[model samples]
Target: MSEIQEEAVLEQDQIIVESGRPKMLGYVFGFFAVTLLGYFLVNRYYMPAPAVNTAPAVRFAPSELLNDLNKRLAYLQNRTTGVSFYIHTIRKKENLWKLASKRHYSVHAIIGCNPQFETYDVSIGQKIIIPSRAGTLHPVQKNDSWQKIASRYKTTLPELVKYNNTALDIGYGDLVFVPDRRPDMALMNDKLREKYELRALFVSPLGGRLSSTFGRRKHPVTGQYKLHGGIDIAVKTGTWVGAAADGVVTLASDGVGHYGKAVFVDHQDGYVTHYGHLSKILVRPGQKVKARQLIARSGSTGRSTGPHLHFTIKKNDVSKDPLKFIW
Candidate 1:
């Protein structure tokens, strides 16, 4: 009975061990499969895809691109280095030509820095900024563009931008340097141009009350309306009258035409001055006279009503208002 029972138990044990071995092997294989699948899924989600081998349509060589970059850097440096500025105080006998000659700069450069000057004439004690290089300092206005500025100055846009060492964008009131350019006097403001022209005229010969203005008026002697060629300034007989400008006396005669005891002076430049109704003549024909020099005496002359001096200025033989020249 013992042997039979032992044999049956041993057989059952062997079967159970074999069956458990297969189950354990399956579990290990399943665990490894699941881990391998998870690894693959994670790689697909996180890792970058391989790059395609497509060529670009346009390609620059490395050397060429590098050279271009270096050139740009050098140009930027040169543009920055070219700019410099300093201020100067004007002195007597120092004109723009002299100042520009000293610095090897142009008159335009000086005028560009001093936008406040209405005329080419510079006064003593005037403060002006001088640029190291020749250029115009153009003030940027509203809606101003590099193209517009360049066109106005008759320069290229790239050159203008390069001269300024700035971007194409310029804000209002910004001063942009235009290289090798001058201020366009014709483009100057009307008031400023007028002021410039007015300064070019001769100073008044002498200060006196303006009894009559220039233009068409009722004739004092004829009592008829007509354009008076000259202006009548009332003065006592023998009152000293001076030359209005530097000139050569063309004529000094008594009772000439309507101008009684008149003296005519030729100031060149198509300008001529007439002094009529003189009590005495202090100058002779073909005699050179300076401005403010005593040339004649005032008196009733040239069809006048009372003691007065008749003065006239002619440009190219055209009569102009005396007040415009003397006042």
Candidate 2:
């Protein structure tokens, strides 16, 4: 081979080597750029997001939620009614009397709502059913008149008619809602005595001194502590017993236990007077009697130690001190 040919071949080899090296470097850089871009896109759009540190959401049972709603609805309904019924958790040193006084309710009103609680048997931490208003439910009897029913509940005819929105003549088996009707205290103190001057404030059941007062006492026969439901007026047997107030006879019989030959008169305004220990009952059930009218004869009847008349005054089935009401 000639020298010139050898030089040309060497120069060609150098050129090829230099050019191939540059192209190879460009290819490598392009592949690296594409790989880096692909990685960035996958992280931005395709990969799952990072976890966040937070508490799990709380869930409630469907039944529990429904019950809560129902309780709230019931409470609202009770408020809508004239009387609101609620559950009261008894507090320390709390009693029914204090509760009643604080709530402006009578002791008997509390008893009427909570029939399970005795006069002195309530204790602390007891759950009691409380009523916002005082009253009772009365079922109308056959041949019942509005005047008679209003007098029976101690409410006025207008109030009775308006509350029930019924006619003066009510039918049999009708339900009557009677609200607690009481004379205005301020007016009663001023006008009651003058208005009813002809009628005695209250007539004694029998002509005798009081033997025992109403309150807690030891039973004479049982020797156990008990609540004396009435006042005892000691008298001779066969003494006439007069009605304490004008009222209709609710019960007149010997059917009452511990009080034989008894008579019950229901006066207007939720007032009821009971005469017990009678030898003879002169009145029959449903008969109307005026105040001071003769209704029975006193005697030593069931659970009595001597001849006397047991007199009791009640408001809406709750007993009251007779002395507070009678003159």
How far in Å is the alpha carbon of 30 misplaced in model 2? 99
**Prediction RMSDs, each to the true structure:** 31.3, 31.5
Candidate 2 vs. true structure, TM-score: 0.40
lDDT tens per residue, model 1, 269-323 = 8999888888889889999999889998888866777888888889999998875
- Tell me each candidate's TM-score: 0.43, 0.40
Query: What is the C-alpha lDDT profile of model 2 across 11-106, one tens digit per residue?
Result: 987876778988768877999999999877654344233223143322233233223433433422322233455678788878766788787866
lDDT of each: 0.70, 0.66
Q: Which candidate ranks first by lDDT, i.e. highest?
A: 1
- The reply for model 1, stretches above 4 Å from the true place, is 1-188, 195-199
Error of 1 at 44 (Å): 82
The clash tally of candidate 1 reads 2
Question: How accurate locally is residue 91 in candidate 1, as Cα lDDT from 0 to 100?
Answer: 97
